[model samples]
Target: MGRKNAGIKTVCENRKARHDYFIHETYEAGIALQGTEVKSLRAGRANLKDSYASIQNGEIFVENLHISPYDQGNIFNHDPLRRRKLLMHKAEIVKLFAKTREKGFTLVPLKIYFKQGRAKMEIALASGKHNYDKRQDLHEKAAKREIERALKDRQRY
Candidate 1:
């Protein structure tokens, strides 16, 4: 299941992350955004799909994340898909790097939102899901939905 992001202004989300991977843990990290990039994100022009975090030289960076160029920025607009740095603690980065080194573990961005007027991203430590596992998840969700509908109908009588 996806993380619950209540009481926050969500800019964009990777809706398929939960379906494609089994999330183990999540972290809230500040994004290092350029002036135009921040404006673009505030205007709701961002995509988290296919974005992933990688630790390089003991620092974390998010790759493939697209924040569209601000409409009025023109010549000063930042690159839409530049590698953005993520602000996280030293010890946490080391821990995450070690975990990602393990087989089948990776970092996936779940969502991006503004918290107390600052841009924050929710990144997850996840493992990929096999075809059979995906099928099972679908079936379980269907069953839960049917049960809820049946109970609602019963109460209406």
Candidate 2:
């Protein structure tokens, strides 16, 4: 049998968001896409590196998410960097709205993937990581890597 999530296709991921922000809460929301955008995504031509989510007029939207136009589309092609709406429950939206209004909290798009044949976005409630925090994390990771390597070498010996 195949994996449970075998049908999912990851179009893009914002790796920098994880490095720059401390994620607090995460949500999976459906994305609104046009015909050409969907076609482009099926071809794996999307970029979410600099994308983020925002609340406006009691609704949530994703900004700066680039979806390349379909090759066969000309006039029917949608804008590559359009702001798309995210579909979420009212309670979730309200919570996200409240959390983002606080100091240093933000809504970032971590990844975009097709789930169950529908496009979905992974949104994270996060706070910006300071320079010192990032440095400490790097140091910790390096130390862990060194220890793991040492253990492997000792086992081999």
Best by lDDT: 1
Clashes of 2: 0
Cα displacement (angstroms), candidate 1, residue 124, comes to: 0.2
Report the lDDT tens digits of candidate 1 across residue range 70-134. Answer: 99998999989999999999999999999999999999999999987899999999999999999
Q: Estimate the TM-score for candidate 1.
A: 0.95
Provide TM-scores for the models: 0.95, 0.95
Residue 103, model 1: Cα distance from true site in angstroms: 0.4
Worst 10-residue lDDT window, candidate 1: 1-10
- Flag clash pairs in model 1: none
Model 2 Cα shift for residue 111 (angstroms): 0.2
lDDT of 1 at 40: 88
Which residue pairs in candidate 2 have backbone atoms (N, alpha carbon, C) closer than 3 angstroms, thus clashing?
none
